[model samples]
Target chain A: MIPNLTLAVVAGVLFATGVYLLLARSITRALLGIVLLSNGANVLLLVAAGPAGEAAFYGRTPESDMSDPLPQAMVLTAIVITLGMTAFILAMAHRSWQLSQTDIVADDVEDLRLVELAVRDVAPHDEERPDVDDDAAGDDRPPGPGTDAVVEP
Target chain B: MTGIDWDILVPLPVVLALAGAGVAVVVTGRIRLQRAVSVVTLSLVLVVALALLVGADREGPLSVTVGGWPARMGVVLIVDRLAALMLVVSATVTLGVLLYSIGQGAASTDEERADEQAPLPIFHPTMLVLSAGVSNTFITGDLFNLYVGFEILLASSFVLLTLGGSAPRIRAGISYVVVSLLASVILLSAIAMLYAATGTVNMAQMAERLDALPEGTRLVLQLMLLVAFAVKAAVFPMFGWLPDSYPTAPAPVTAVFAGLLTKVGVYSIMRTQTLLFPGDQLTELLMWAALATMLVGILGAVAQDDIKRMLSFTLVSHIGFMLFGVAVGTAAGISAAIFYVAHHITVQTTLFLVIGLIERYGGTTSLTRLGGLAKLAPVLAVLFFLPAMNLAGIPPFSGFLGKAGLLQAGAEQATWLAYLLIAGSVLTSLLTLYAIARVWSRAFWQPPIEPATEGLERVPRGMTLPAAALVAVGLAITVVAGPLFAVTDRAAADMLERAPYIDAVFPGGVP
Candidate 1:
C-alpha cells in the first residue's frame, strides 16, 4: 500500500517542534509540547493507515475499497487518551501556579541540595554537610522568642 | 477436571478492579465502605489470579477474546505462565499495599476527621484503577490494548503521585508526567509502525509477520520499542526522573509505584523480546545497559542521606538484575529474571512500607536525624532488618536465590560480555549490602543525636501488621524457593519457545 507523504511530513514537523517546546523550563510550554507530541503520534497513526479510500463501514463499502479501519480506530483511542492527559496536566499546571505563582517548573529540593554539596566539594554523608535542614523545617517551626523580642522593640 | 471455566477468569482481574473502582467512587463519602469495596475487589482479583496461575501452568495457557470477537479482529486476554505469574505477584502487592495504606490512613487521622483529611477520598478509586491498568498490561494480547493499559495506570499514577496538590509533589509530578508521556508517545509511534509493517497489532499475528520483514526494518522497529520501554523501565541514562520523583510521594504511593510500575515496563520488554524478537541481535547491547544500570543506580544509592531516596535508587539498581537475566537470552536466564521481578516487587514494597514506619517512629527519614531505633522500636528494627538483608541478597532470602540464578545463567552463557555482567552483578550486590549496612548503623545502631523526641505516639499496630505480613511473605518466598523456581523455569521455557503463547492466542494458527 502507498503511504501518505504529506501526512508523514506534517507528523515529522509536529514531532520536531513538540520536542523543542518540551525541553523548555515552563510548565505551560511543556504541556503544549505534550499536546503536540501526542497529535504528532496520532498523525503518524493516520499515515500508517495507507492511502485513503472508502470509509470502513462494512456493507456500506466493498471490502477491497475500504481504508484500513484499524489504524483509524487506534487514532481515535490515542486522541481520547491525549485529551485526558492534557486536561490532567493543565490542572497540575494551574495547581503549580496557585502554589508557587510561577509557571516555571521548580528544581527538586533534594537534587538541588546534592548539587550544592557537590559544588562545595563536600560529601553528602559527611558531618560537615550543609545545614540545609533549615529549608525543610522552616515552614513547620513555630516562631522563636528572638523574633518576638525584635518585634516588640 | 473440576469443571470450573478457568478461561472465563482470564480477564476478571482487570474487569473486577475497574468495576470496583466505579463502586468505590460512588461510595466516596463512606470511607469504611470504600475501603471495604477496594479490599474485597482486590481479594477477588487475588483469587482469580491464583486460579489463572494454576490453570495456565497445568493447561499450558488460557485465553479469552473480549466480547466474543474474533481473535484477529478484536482484543485478546491471554494468561500464559509469564502473564499469570505477573498477575499473581502484582495482585498480592497491590492488596498488601492497600491494606497498609488503610492502616496508615487510620493512624495518621482519627475516623471523624478522615472524611475531610488526607489519604483523600480519591485514593481508593485511583488505586483500584491503577491495579486494573497493571493487570490489563499483564494479560493483554493486543499491542494497542497494552498501550491503553499503560495509559490507564499512568494517568492514575499521576494522580497518586501528586495527591492533595502539595507543592513538593506537584514539582515532582511535572517531571514524572512529562517523562512518562514522552515514553507513551514513543510506544504509540512504534505500535503504529509495527501495524504498518505487519498489517495487524495482535501480538501473535505480528510475531508471525515480523519475521518476514527485512532485517533493517525489523531492527528499527525493535529499537523504537526498546527505547520506549527502557525509559519506562528506568534503565541507565533515562532513569533521572525516577529518583527525583518517586521519593516525594506519600509512602504507600511510593511503595506501590516502586514495586509495580517499572516491573510493568520490564515485563513488556521481556514479552517483546521473547515473543516478537527472539534473537541475540540486541542481547549484547542489553547486557551493557544492564551493567551500567546496576553500577550507577547503586552508586547513587550509596550517596543518598534519605532512606526513601536511597531505597528508590536501589529499586532502579535491581531492575538491572532482571535486565541481565533477559539479556542472557537463555531459558535459565529468563526464568531467573521472572523470579527476580517477583522477588523484587515484594521485597521493595515491603521495605518502603517499613521505611514509612521508620519515618513515623523517628519523626524523619533523614539518616542524620534517626538514631537508637533498635532500642526504641525492636519490632520496627526487625521489620526493617529482614527486608534490608533480603534486599542486600543475603543467603536463604529470595533476593539471593534470584541473583544466584541470574549469575548462574550468565555463567552458562559464557560469553565475554555475560562474564562481565556476572561480575557487575556481584559488585552491585556487594554495594547494596554496603548501602544497607550503612543505613543500619546510622539509623538503628548509632546513639541518638538528639534524645528521642517526647510524646511520639507508638506506631499503630494496624500499620505494622500489614508491613510485617509483607515481610513474612518475603521470607515465605525463600521457604518455597524450590517450587517457585520450578514454576519460573516452566514459565521461562514457555516464553522462550513462544509457541505456547501464540497457540493460545490463535489455536487454529495465524490466519
Candidate 2:
C-alpha cells in the first residue's frame, strides 16, 4: 500500500492547520492557509490515484503497475493555479499594506451601515436626513467607524 | 457519423477569443485598436454561437471529440440543445457587456484606463480571456476540462475584480479569490474521488458507473459535486461572498459577473443531475435550499440602500427559481428552469447596465441620494422600468412565463415540498416587484431631496445606447418566447432522455 495511511494523516493535519489559519484576521495568515490547503489537496489527489505504482511512462512498467499519469498532470496544473492565485493574493496584500499599513481586511462601511440600520430598525426610505448626517460627517470626520482611511498620515 | 457538422463551430469561439486576447495584449496601449479588436471578436463569436444554436435545434445534439482520442478519453465539445442555447445566451450577454463597456468609455478613457496591474492596460485582454473561458465552460463535456474552464475564468476575474487596486476593490477581491479557490479545491477533490471510484471522468461514462456504486459512496460524491457547484452558483448558505464582492466592482465588470457566473454553476448542477445521477434522492434537499435562496435573497435585497447590492441579492434569489424547477425532476420543470436561466441572464445584465446609466445620469445609485430621474432622463426611466418589471415576473414578459412554467410543473408534482416552492416562488416574485418598485419610486419618481448633481458627468450616448440595446435584448426574449420555449422544451426532452447525449458523445455508447 506504500504508506497510504501516512499521506492521509498528513493531509488531515494540514487541513486542520489550514482551516485554523484561514479564519485568522491577518491576510498573510489567510494566504498561508490557502497554500497549505492547496498542498493538502494535491496530496489527496495523488492518494486518489491508487497507493502503489511505478512511474507512468512508455517503458517504465506494465500497464497494470503503471502509475496513473493523469492525476499527476492534474496536480501539476493545480499547483500552477495555486501559484497564480498566490501571486494575486500577495499583490492584494501588498496593496492593502500600501493603502492601510495593514494586511487585514477591514469591515466594509456600507455593510456596517446596513447592519446598523437593521439593528436600529431604520426604514430604508426614511434613512436620508439624520442617517447621512450621522455617518457622512459625524463630528466632521473623513470616514465613520467601519470605514478605514487609506494612505497613512 | 454526422459528417463533421458541429466540429468546426466547436473550437472557433474559444479560438477566436484567445486570438483576440493575444492581439489586444500586443496593442495594449492603443485604446482605439483595443476597442475595434474586442468588438469584432465578440460579435463574431455571437454570430457563430447563434448558428450553432440553430443547427443544434434542427439537428438534435452535436458533439466532437478532440484530437481524435475516441470516446471516454478525448475532450468532447458538445452542442446539445441545452448547451447550444446557453452558448447563444452567454454570447449575447457577453457581447452586450463588451459593447456597453466600450460605449461607456470604461476602457477607452485614459483616466479610467489607469493601470494598476502593469504598465499596459489589461482590461481588453482580460475580458477577451474571460469570454473565452466562459465559452469553454459551456462546451466542455468531460469533468476535469470543466474545472480547467472555471480556472481560466476565475484567473481572468481576479484581475478584473481588483482592476484599480483601490481599497474597496482589493478587499472585495480577497474574498472573491478565497471563496473561488475554496470551490476549486472542493471540485478537484470530488473529481479525484470520482476518478478513483469509477476510473473515468468522462460524464457519459460516469453515468453508467455511478448507479452501480454503493448508495453511501454515490451520495457522498454527489454531495461533494453539488456543494462545489452550489458555492459557485451562490445558493443561500454559500452566497455570503457574492453581495460583498460584486457591488465593489466597476459597472461593466459587475454586470457580466452578476449575469453569467452563478448561472454557469446552476447549469452545471442541472447537467450533472440529469446526466450522471438521474434520480430524486436529493430533490427535497435542493427544493428546500431553493426556497431559502429565494426568500433570503429577496429579503436581503429589500434591506439594501444601494442599487447594485440589491440587484446582486436578487441575482442570488432568482437562481432559486431555476433550482426549484430542476428539483421537481420532470421535463416541464427542467424546461422551465432552462428558460428561466436564459431569461435571467439577459434581464439581470440589462438591469445592471441600466444601473450603470442610472449612476451616470443621477450621480449616485443610493436611493437616498437619487431622485427625479423620471423627468431628468425618461429614456433611462424606460430602460430601468422594463427590465425591472420583467425581472419581477410581470405578465406577458419572459420572466413571467418562465416562472409560470415552473409553478405549473411544481403543481403537477403534488409533493408538499413542491407546494412550498410554489408558494415561495409566487411570494418571492411579488417581493421582487416590491423591491424594484421601491427603487423606482425613490430613485426616479420622487423629487430629489438635494437634486443629485447630474449635469456634472454629462451622460454620453456611448453608455446610454448600449443600455438601450441590452434592454431591447431582454424585450426580444418576450417576443420570441413561443419558439424559445419550444427550444427549451426540446432541451428538457433531450436531457431527460440521456441516450441521445451519451450516444452522440460516445458514438456507440458508454458501455
Candidate 3:
C-alpha cells in the first residue's frame, strides 16, 4: 500500500501540471489541462479514501474492492463529460479559425464599423422613389388650387 | 398499509428516460416529427411530475430501491416533496420554452430546414438528456449519483452553449467548459473523501456518518463540497464564465438554460448545507457570499448594453436571494428559497424570450440600435412588461411574494448577516429595475430610427406566437400567486423536516 502522504504528493504534482497547462494560450492545451486537473482530483479522491487495490474497468476482484467505488464512479462521469466538452470546444475553435483565419479571439469593432459604413454609403431605393412620385401625380386632386376649400373658391 | 407507500421513487427516472427517448426520435432528422414529439413528451412528463408531487406531498419520504438491492448497498431513488415539486417546475418551464421554439420556427418559415450548420438536429435531444439528468439529480438518494447527474447535464450543456458555433460563442464555450470541468473535479475529490471516511456514498447514510467525524475533517469536506457547487451555481467570484457563455447561445437555449441550470446548483447547495452539515458556521460563509453575488450580479447587469448579456448577469445576481434563504438555515428561509427559485425561473425565461422577440422586430439586441418597439408591437411591449416587473420584485407578483418571505425569515433571525441580506436584496431589486428601464427606454419608448426600420419590422409568425405565449405565462403566474406560493410553502416545509427523507430511504432506520 502506498503511504497517504506519497499519494497526496503525486496528486499535487498532477495538479501543478494541470494548472500550468490551463494557463496556456491555446484553447486545445487549456482543455487538456482541464482533463489533467480532473484526473489529478480523482487521484486525490482515491488518496483521501486510503489505500486500495487496482481495479480494472470491469472486474470483481480484491484490487477493485480495495479502492473506493464512489470516487471511481464520479471519475468515470467526469471523464465522459470532459470528452463531450473537449470535442465541442475543438469544434468551436475550428469554426472561429474558419471565420477569421485565426484561432485567437477577434475584436468586433471592425465588423461594427463595416456595417455602419455600408448603411451610410448606399442609397437603397432611388429608382423606386420616382415611380412613387409619378403614381401620385395621376391622382384626382385639382392642380395649383389657391382656395382653402372648393366651395370658397 | 392503506396509505401510499413511501418506498417508490425509481419509476420517476424511468418516465424521464422515456421522455428522452421520445425527444431523441424527434431530433434524429425529422423536423416536423421532432416538434410534435417534443411537445407531447414534455406534456406527459409534466403531468406525471404533478402526479408525483401531489401523491408524495403528504406521504412520508418515498424511496425506491433500485435493482432490488437494499438502500445501503444499491442505488436509491428518493422523491420527497421538494424533489417532486422541482421536477414539475422544470417540466413546466421546459414545455413553455419548447413551444416558443417551435412557434418561432413556424413564423420564420425556417421550420422546414434550419440554416446551414444550424443546430436544432442536436439541440432537442440534448435538452431531453439535460432534463433527464436534472430529474436524476433531484431523485437520487446518493451523492455519487448526484455527481453523475451533474456530468450528464453539463455534457449536454456544452453542445447547447455553442449550438451555432459563432465566434463569440466559441470563445465563451472555452471558458465555460474549463471552469465547469474544474468544479467537477473538485466535486469528485470531495465525494472520494466522504466515501473514504464513511465507507458509503448514499447522502442519507453520509449525513448520519458525518456527525461522528472530527470537526476539522468535516469542515474540509463541507468547504470542498460548497466550493464545487458554488462554481456550478455561478456564485459571486466563481460566476465569471456564466455571463459570457449564456449570451452567446440561441435565445430559446438561453431561456431554458437560464431558467433551470444554475438553480440545480443552488438546489444542491441547499441540500448539502441542510443535510450534511446542519449548523451556523457554513451559513455565515454563505450569507456573505450571497450578498456579494447579489451586488455583483446587478451591477454587471446595469453596465451591459446588450439585452441578453444584461439578463445573464442578473441571473447570476438573483442567485444570492435564493442562497440567502438557505443561508438563514431556517424552515421559512429554505421555503422562501424554493418559492424564489420557482418564480425566478419563469420570470427570467420569459424576459429572455421577450429579448428574442425584440431582436426579431428591431434587428439587433444592442440598446443603441433599438427604439420605438411599443408602437410597432404593442403585444411585445405588454409581454416584456410583466416579467420585467416580476424580476424587479414589484408588488403583486410571485417575485415580490418570494422576496417578502425571504425578508421575513431574515428578520426573524435579525443578525448583522440577515441585515446585510435584506439590504442586498433591496439594492439588487432597485438595480434590476434600473436595468429593465434601460431596456424599456432604449428598446420600447424612444422614436424609431429610419435606419433601424428598413428590413427590420418583419417578425415571423412562428417567433411572435412563442413570445406571446411566454408573456401570457408570466401574467398567469402573477394572477395565480396564491396557489403557487402555497405549493412553494409546502415544498419548503418538506425539505427542512428531514425525517421523511431519511425514513424513506432507510425504512429499518440507520445502523
Q: Pick the candidate with the highest DockQ.
A: 1
Ranking by TM-score: 1, 2, 3
Which candidate should be chosen as best, given TM-score against the real structure?
A: 1
- Colliding pairs, model 2: none
> Taking the tens digit of each residue's C-alpha lDDT, what string does model 1 give over A48-76?
99989999888999998999889998999
Candidate 1: tens digits of C-alpha lDDT, residues B1-511: 2314989898899999999999999999898999999999999999999999999989888889999999999999899888998999999999999998898887775653353234558999999999999999999999999999999999999999988788888889999999999999999999989988998999999999999999999999999999999999999989999999999888889999999999999999999999999899999999999999999999999999999999999999999999999999899999999999999999999999999999877779999888888998999999999999999999989999999999999999998999999999999999999999999999999988887569356888888999999999999999999999999999999988888899888887889
Which pairs in model 3 have colliding backbones? B6-B62, B103-B462, B104-B462, B104-B463, B107-B461, B107-B462
Q: Count clashing residue pairs per candidate.
A: 0, 0, 6
Give one digit per residue, the lDDT tens place, for model 3 in B324-367: 99999888888889878878888898889888888777778998
Model 2 chain B worst lDDT run, 10 consecutive residues: B107-116
Candidate scoring better on lDDT of 2 and 3: 2
Instruction: Residues A1-153, candidate 2: write the lDDT tens digits.
Output: 343788778878887898888888788999999899888888887877776678877776788888878788889988998999899899899998998887777766455665554534433423565645444333223343334432221
Q: What stretches of model 3 exceed 4 Å from their correct place?
A: A1-3, A53-74, A100-153, B1-10, B13-19, B22-27, B109-120
Q: What TM-score, over all chains together, does every model reach?
A: 0.94, 0.93, 0.87
